[model samples]
Target: MTRDKHDFKKVVPFAFLIFTIAEFIPVLAYFFPSSLPRNVLTYSQKRKLIEKRDSIRIQIHTHINNSAKTNKGSDNAPLISQRDFINSTNARLVSKKYASSFDLSKTADFKTAKLMCKFFGLSSIGTFSMLKSRLAAHATFLRTDDSLLFKDLDSTVAGLSTVQLIEACDSRGIPTTNFSFPHLKNSLVGWVQFSNSFSTIEPGFYLWSRIFLLSKIPTTN
Candidate 1:
C-alpha cells in the first residue's frame, strides 16, 4: 500500500505538468499576431473611415480659426505661437509616454493642439479608438519593414513651415507618395495603427515597456 501510494503521487505531478504546458500553448500563440498576414478592409468600410477622417479635419479648421482670433489680441503671440507649434509637433512624433511627461498640452496653444490633432487625428480616446477600429475591421498587423517607408516621408513634412503644413493638410487628399503632406499624415496613422495592433497582442509587454520608460529618472545623492 505504501509503494502504491508513492506511485500515485508521482503520477499526479506529471499529469499537472502536462496540463500546465497544454494551457500555455494558446497563450504563447496569441502573443505573436505580428506574424500574421495583413487583413484588408472592404471598399465601403474604407469609404466610411475616410468620411469620418474628413469630418475631423473640418473640426480642426474651426478650432484653428477660433484660436487665431483669440490669440490676436496678445502682443507676444506670434513668437510664442511658433514655438508652441514646433513643440507640439515634436510631442506628437515622440511616444505618448514621453509626450505626456512633457505636458505638451500645457505647452501648446489651442491652435497648435488643434492643428496637431487635425494632422494626427488625435483625441483623448485616440489610441483606444484605433484599436477598436482595427479589431472591428479585422485589420492585420503592419509589415516590419514599413518603418523605412515613413522615415523619408516624415523628413519631407518636417522641413515645411507651420503655415505650409496647415495649408498642405487643407488641400491634400490621401497621400500616395513620400513627397507630400498626405504621405506624412498616412505614416502617422500607420504608426498608431501598428502600435495598437502590437499592444493588443501582448498588452502586458506594452504596459511593461511604458512603465519601464516612465520609471527612469535622474537620482541625486
Candidate 2:
C-alpha cells in the first residue's frame, strides 16, 4: 500500500505539469500566430521602379515641348513667314499625334497648339494652308464690318502659309507686307490670318496664344 501511494504521488506531479502545459498552449497560440508576409521591398526593385517613373515623365515632357516648338517658333525665332508657320503647324500635328499616343495631356509644358492639332487631325500641309486661307477671310470680314474679330491672331498666323496669306491681304487691299527672316513682325494682316484660323476651331490655349500674338501687333486704329 505504501509503495503504491508513493508511485501515485510521483505520477500526480507529472500529470499536473502536463495539464499546465496543455492550458498554456491555447493562450500562446492566441497571442502569436504564424509569421506574416514582409512589407519591405529590395533596394534594387525600388530603384528600378523609380527609374521607370522618371523616364516616363521625361518622355511625356519632351513630346509636349516638341509639339509646341514644331508648331510655333522658338522664343528667339518667332515665326514671321507664313510658309514657315504652315510648315511648322503641319510638322507639329504629326509630332503631337505621335506624342499623344503616350498621353500628352499628362506632360508639363504642354502647348495648346498640339492639343488643337490632335483634336482636329490637321496633319497635312494642304489642310493647314486651306485652313489659313479661311481664317484670312474671317479677318477681312471683321476688319470691314468692324465686328468682334475672333480674339487672337498670333496663333492663327502660326498656322498659315505665306503665299495664301499674302494673297488674301492683297485682295483685301491690306498693305503688302514683309517679315524679317528670323524676327518676323506681327502685323494686322498676320493677326487677321490668326483670327480667321481660330474662329474655325474650338477655343483653347493654342487658340488663345494665336489671339495673344495677333493682339500684340501695332494697330493703326
Candidate 3:
C-alpha cells in the first residue's frame, strides 16, 4: 500500500505539467480567452498582424504623403485644425497603469489653468471655468499625434502589430477610425513617409504645463 501511494503522487505531478503546457497554445487561448492577457498580443497573433501590414505598405505611403501635401497649402501647417484632429482620436488613450496619474480636476485654479489651455490652442476665443478648459486641454493633448513621426518611408516604420498600433496611438493621441485592418495599415505607412512642416506637436502632454503635475511635489495655500 505504501509503494502504490508513492507511485500515484509522481504520476499526478507529470499529468499536471502536460495540462499546463497544452492550455497555453494558440488554439487553447481562444477557448480560454480569460487566461490570456486581453490587450497584449501573443507571438502568433503579432506575426499575423505584421504580415498583413507589410502586404499593403505602398497604399499607405502614397495616401499619407499626398494627403499631407494637399492639406498643407500655403502656411507650413496642416489644414486640419489641431483641436479638431486631436478630438477625433480615440478617447481611451491612457493605459490603466498610468491612468491614475492623470490629474484632470477642479482643484486646479482659474486664471493660471486657462492661460495654459489657450497657449496649447485647445479652445475657441475664450472659455468657461478653468475645469472645463483643463479637461478640454488634457483631451486635446492626449489626442494630438503624428504618423510614424513623419519620418522617411523607406526606413523601418510600420513595424507595430495591431494591438501595438492601438496602444501607441492611444498613448500619443493619433487619429484612427473604424477602417479595415488593411486600410488602416496603408494609411499609417503613407502618413509616416510624407515629409511635412505640419507645425503640429506629435508627442503631446509632456509639455502641457497644466494637465499633469508632479504628484510628489508639495502644494501650499
Candidate 4:
C-alpha cells in the first residue's frame, strides 16, 4: 500500500507540470506571432507626409505675396486693400483658428485662400461679410501693415475648412445677426455682441482688438 501511494504522488506532480506547460504554450503564441512582423510607418510614408505639408505651405506664401503687391500703393497705404483684406482675413481665421499649425514662412496663397474658406464659415456671403467686418476691426486696431497682416491673415484663413469654422463659432455660443443685402446670401451677417456686464467698452471695438491680439502670437506646430 505504501509503495502504491508513493507512485500516485509522483504521477500527480508530473501531470500538473504537463498541464502548466500546455497552458503556457497558447498564451505565448498569442503575444508573439510567428508568421508576421509588426506593421510600422515606413520612411517613405513619412517622407510623403512631409512633402504634402510643404506643398500647402508654399501655396499660402504665394497668395499673401501676390495680394500684398496688388495693393501696394493706394489711399489705403497702411490700410489693407479691400480685396487683400478679404483674402487675408479669411486666411487668418481659418489657419489660426481651424487648421493644423504649419510653418507660416513656407505657405503659398491658394493654400491660404482654401484654408480661409474652410475655417471662417465663409461658404455664403453673409458669413463672409461677418468675417470681413471682424477682420477690418482687427486691422484697424493693430494699424497693421497690409502686407504683414495679409500673411498672417492668409495663414489663418487657409487653416480651416468652411464647415469646421462654422461649427467652432457655434460651439463658442457667439450670436449671429441678420441683415438684408441684395448681393449677399441669406442677407444675414453674424456679429458677436459685447456684454456691458464684462466691460464698458463697445462690444464691436473690443472684439476687434481681440482679433488683433491673436494675430501677433507666433504660429504653433
Candidate 5:
C-alpha cells in the first residue's frame, strides 16, 4: 500500500502534466489560428484529402507569385522568371506521385523510390522531377517574407516528406540541423504524417523537441 501510494504520487503529476498540455493546445491554437492547418481530415478520405491538398498548393503558389512580382527589383528578392515558374510548376506536378511515395517506413519501397529518383536524375527526364519540385517549392517560398512562411511551406511540401528531404538536402549540399521533418509533421498532425515522418522522429530527441514546443504557453503581458 505504501509503494502503491508512492507510485500514484509519481504518476499523478505526469498525468496532470499531460492534461495541462492538452488543455493548453486549444488556447495556443486559438491565438495562432493561422499556424494550424485548415482542417484535419482522416487519410482514409482520399478524394477529399487530395482535393484539399491540391487547393492549398494552388493557393500557396498563387500567393507566392503575387508576392514575388511585387518585390521583383531587390537583389535578394524573388525574381523567378515567369517562364521558369510555369515550367517548374509543371515539373513538380509530374513527380508529385513519386514524391508522395518516398516514405521510409517501408524500407524496400523507400529504396526503390530512391533508385527511381536517381533514375530520373540520370535519365533524360526534364527538370529532375524531385529536385524540380523542391526548387519550385523553394522559389514560391522565396517570393514571400512571412515569418511563418517556412513552417507553412514545410507543411505544404510535406508530400516530399522527411527521408526525401534529408536526401534532397544532402544531394544539394544544403546544411541541416538535427531537427527532423517527420518530427515536426507528426506533431503538427497530432499522430503521424505517414511513414517517413513518423520513422524520422521515432524514439528520438526530435520527438522531444516537438513536445517541448507544444508544451509552451504563449505569454501576454
Candidate 6:
C-alpha cells in the first residue's frame, strides 16, 4: 500500500506540471496576448537554443545578402522575369495539352516552364530546346532569397494548424518560448504575405526578421 501510494504521489506532480504547461499556459495566453510566460527551458538549454537560433538567422542573412550575384537579365533570359511571374501570360497562352499535341517549342511558357528556368539559375527558358537544361538545373535555387522559403510553404495560414509554423519559427530562432500560438502564427503569416508582394528580396527578409523580433518576448518579463 505504501509503494502504490508513493508512486501515485510521484505521478501527481508530473501530471500537474503537464496540465500547467499544456492547458493552463494556453489559457493564460489566449487572455493575455501581448504578455507571455517565459523561459520554460533550463539556463543551459536556453543558451543552446539561442546559439542555434542565432547561427541559422545569420545563415539566412548571409543567403539574402549574397543573392545579388546571379544577375537576372541575360540575352537569353526568360521573357518572363521573376517579379512578373505571377501575372505572366505565358501560362494562359500555352496549355499543357497544346504543348503536348503540337510542337509549341517556340512558345515561351514563362509562368510555368520559363519561370522554372529563372528559379533554377538557367539563363534561358525560352525554348523547349532547354528542357534538358531546366531539368538539370532543377536542383538549384538562383534567387537565394525568402521566396525560396515559400516554395514549399503553404501560404494558407487560416487552417489553425500551428505545427509547421511553430517548426519554421523555432528553426528561425524566433524564441518559441511564450507567445500565444495564434498571435505568433498570425504575425508570421501576415508578415510573409505582406512581404511576398514586393518585387525585390529585401522586403521579405525585412518582414520576416521583424516577426522574428516580435516573437522574442522575454520569457520572464
lDDT of each: 0.34, 0.34, 0.36, 0.30, 0.32, 0.38
Look at candidate 3 and give me any clashing residue pairs: 60-186, 60-190, 61-190
Best by TM-score: 1
Per-residue C-alpha lDDT of model 2 across residues 62-158, encoded as one tens digit per residue:
4544544555445654232222223335424433444433232333333433333322222213344344433333333434422232343445545
The superposed Cα distance between candidate 2 and the true structure at residue 49, in angstroms, equals: 64
TM-score list, all predictions: 0.28, 0.20, 0.25, 0.22, 0.21, 0.28
Q: Output the number of the lDDT-best candidate.
A: 6
- Give the per-residue lDDT of model 5 (tens digit) for 13-108: 445645678666455444532222323212333234333333433443355356546755457654432332122232233224334322223224
Q: Model 6, 1-221: lDDT tens per residue?
A: 00112124345554565766766744443443212322233444434444444454555434433442343357644332222222213222322323342222343444434433332223343455565344333221212323554444344445435554554454333544455677667555543443354444321223223322434322100
What are the runs in model 2 whose C-alpha is more than 4 Å off? 1-149, 177-185, 189-221
Ranking by lDDT: 6, 3, 2, 1, 5, 4
Q: Per-residue alpha-carbon lDDT of model 1 for 56-165, expressed as tens digits? A: 55465445445545644346443112122222232233334344433332333444433443333323234543433322222122222223333454565567553344
RMSD of each: 18.8, 30.5, 18.9, 25.3, 21.4, 18.5
In model 1, the runs with Cα more than 4 Å from the true position are 1-40, 73-102, 105-147, 150-221
Clashes of 3: 3
In candidate 3, position 34 carries an lDDT of 26
Model 6 has an lDDT value of 0.38
How does candidate 5 score on lDDT?
0.32
Tens-digit lDDT string for candidate 4 (55-165):
433454345445645654466562332222123344344334423323222234443334433222222123434444433333233222222323444354346454333
Clash count, candidate 6:
1
Order by TM-score, highest first: 1, 6, 3, 4, 5, 2
Worst 10 residues of 3 by lDDT: 212-221
Question: Could you tell me the lDDT of residue 106 within candidate 5?
Answer: 24
